[model samples]
Target: WHWPTAWCHMFLAPLFAATGLLLRLLLRLLLDLHALFFLPHREAEGFKEQGNAFYIKKDYEEAFNYYTKAIDMCPKNASYYGNRAATLMMLYRYREALEDAQQSVRLDNSFMKGHLREGKCHLSLGNAMAARRCFQKVLELEPDNGQAQQELKNAEAILEYERMAEIGFEKRDFRMVSFPFLRCVMRPLTAASFRQISAPLSGFLLSSPRSDILRMDSTNADALYVRGLCLYYEDCIDKAVQFFVQALRMAPDHDKARLACRNAKALKAKKEEGNKAFKEGSYEAAYELYSEALTIDPNNIKTNAKLYCNRATVGSKLKKLDQAIEDCSKAIKLDETYIKAYLRRAQCYMDTEQYEEAVRDYEKVYQTEKTKEHKHLLKNAQLELKKSKRKDYYKVLGVDKNATEEEIKKAYRKRALLHHPDRHSSATPEVQKEEEKKFKEVGEAFSVLSDPKKKSRYDSGQDLEDDGMNMGDFDANNIFKAFFGGPGGFSFEASGPGNFFFQFG
Candidate 1:
């Protein structure tokens, strides 16, 4: 053991060190764990890279396929799930994306990207409450998450709007409600509420995203006409008119727009005619023209009210007392504070001998009016009320209070002949009825004055109660008997062949 060869052998290294390293390498190859651990992961990363490229290019279909394959290869990978959910969200497949994002979160509870994607999916699906919860959770996990905070604020705003809408609908307070939901869905860029509070916001939504009016192309006329129709429904009458005019300028043969233009033109002409009539003091003509205009445009409030006011004035002037009252009532129904209608109707009632009704209308005008003209009219009405009184029916019949019996008979005969129903065949039914009534009153006056007993009773201011005298009671035979000696004065005899004589002596 103490020899030189033994000392040299003791100082020499092991010959199998290289063999051990080689053996370890062979063992790694046999187990196939190195390729299994790294190569598949590397392939997944390459696929993810390609997917990202395609997604950035907006080739969502290809990106979706590539991401799906990557996710299949790496089933437990949170990043792959997040990418796929994003692509699905872009494709508007929100429900499926929500499931994928939720699975990603389950796989890795600390994944902020997964929470954001899920929240976006919920938002897209109109689940704002759920989206808000998810976004809040993301902010809780990562306090510096600006995107999550912004999204949470948006969700809260949406929730607040929905709550307001619910309260408004419950209380029937539509003016307090905003149409945020419709705006979100339709996404109109330049919207007008169009003075119609209940109108849906989709009415203002343009098919194109741009605000500039489209130029007239070969198809522009058709598009313009369609847009005009939409604008008309949206209550943008001026814009609709412009669109229709443009359409007509481009294609004069467009039947739809031509009809619309013609209707609008006719309506405008009728309105102008009404205004002209009103200015010229032709109230009846103005009412007719306004009514015609309303026939063309039923929703025209100005025309409706103008027609009501003008007709009310016309009815008053024409002495159509009830009609004037109804017209003013309708005018006030259309616009509750129509001072002119109230004033005009008050005057009409005064003319019609309805003092109390006139006073009420005047009071309504006084309550609604702030003008000096109305104040003056109300003062005039009060003065008129003091002077108003019931008219005498006997004076209206144009007969004296103590006319002789022959004079009364002659006057009654003349009046009955003048106002007979047969003389008024072409008159209105109401006029004919009135004439017949006057004729009957004249006959009654003659009958009462002709009878001495009735004349005595009527002269003493006693009410001559009707005893239902028949025509037979006042017949010529009875009058002859009374006038010619009361049942002892008449004789009839056959004097000769075909001849007879009657005598009263």
Candidate 2:
């Protein structure tokens, strides 16, 4: 029985060893399959290493390319997809990055990074609604996403602007006509949000899919361009120009960068031209150039006000009193605190004999005046107003108050010949209208004063006292008969042989 047991043990021991080896091999095979199908560990590791190197060098395009390769190798890897989407966003390819981010979240719905990336992508694409959804998802997953909370707030603000625009349009408010659609759409993006989104998105959009191409890497060029634009808006023109030039050197085909450079140059040239004209005493020319500059950039407050003030000066010099007033009015409209416009307009009104208007303009200037020159201008305007108000109509017409009818007629005709609308046919429409009104008033004044009966009635206190008298009480026909004498007043009768008309009245 002992010998039989020993033989069984030897046979069973080999069988057991074989069984154990087989189980070990099966476990190894399953582990390898898991790594291969779900992770692609080796390929992903290689791509990740390459991506890290590129990212360190700020070469976002190359980084994005490697990250994308890593994602392709490990299709279910949320980290790889999230990283790649981040790189793409750097290139300004927000729409494409958004897809990748969405894919990452679809694969790994619990990944907070994926949701954050998706929200950022949506923000770049001006999809505030989608972005808010992703941000909300991030908050739900990680409740401590401060960045997401801020972004959501920004998106809400932009949405509000769009809503306001829609309301304005529905209400037919023409004042809101200049609101840009993109401005309304991206109202949520503050300067801080712009800096955050643009920096990454620029790199992603300009980068090539191939990781090895250095020339195709647009990270540096895009960064320079974005920084330049920010500087430009911040009023750092020289620094902005430098960045723009550097961006052009890095990427010559960059249209937006080139445009920024050109605009900066044009603005500088326009400013220089206007300054030159102003220095040379060509106020009108200076004003025109400044106006053109303002047209190019309506936000240029200095140029807008400068052009208006300069134009006012030119109008004043040209004796275009109304035009001077208008120019000053525009200046004040652009800058309500502009004391110069009020002073200039006051001067213009005084010149035009509009004493009441001049007084009002002077009072406004006095209230707002800060400089000594402004105060002096206000004082001068007040003095001029007093002088203009005291002007005698007879002195204006260059005739005595009791001038003969013939003298008044002669004076009126002479004045009308010089100040008639036809005489100023070459003037602007506004100027012509003003001159016409003035001439009409002058003619009417002359007509009333030249009429003996009307003049007598005007001189007496009776005409002023008769407040309830109608036009029928005047009896102008009787007045004319009394002035000319007889029924056929001043008739021409040919002295013939015999014509005796005897009236027994």
Lowest-sum lDDT 10-residue window in model 2: 496-505
Query: Which tens-of-lDDT digit does each residue in 1-505 have in candidate 1?
Result: 5797786666653546667888999998976976787777888888999999999999998999989889877889998999999998777556679999999999998899999989877766557788898998899899999999988887776666666656655554423333443333232111111112223222323533543235323356755665665565444556778888998888998877887666666766787787798778887787687667766744333335556677777666656778878877766765576677777778888777677788788778777765787677666666556544422224434677676766765665456556555556557999999987665565555666678887676554445554455422343334334543677576545567534455667
Q: Give the TM-score of candidate 2.
A: 0.37
* True-vs-predicted CA distance for residue 102, candidate 1, Å: 1.2
The prediction achieving the highest TM-score against the true structure is 2
Clash count per candidate = 0, 16
TM-score of each: 0.35, 0.37
Model 1: lowest-lDDT 10 consecutive positions: 188-197
lDDT of candidate 2 over 195-273, digit per residue (tens): 3333233233234254221243345676567556556654466777888899899899988788778877787678679
Candidate 2's C-alpha runs over 4 A off are: 1-5, 9-11, 20-24, 27-39, 174-505
Per-residue error for 105 in candidate 1, Å, reads 1.4
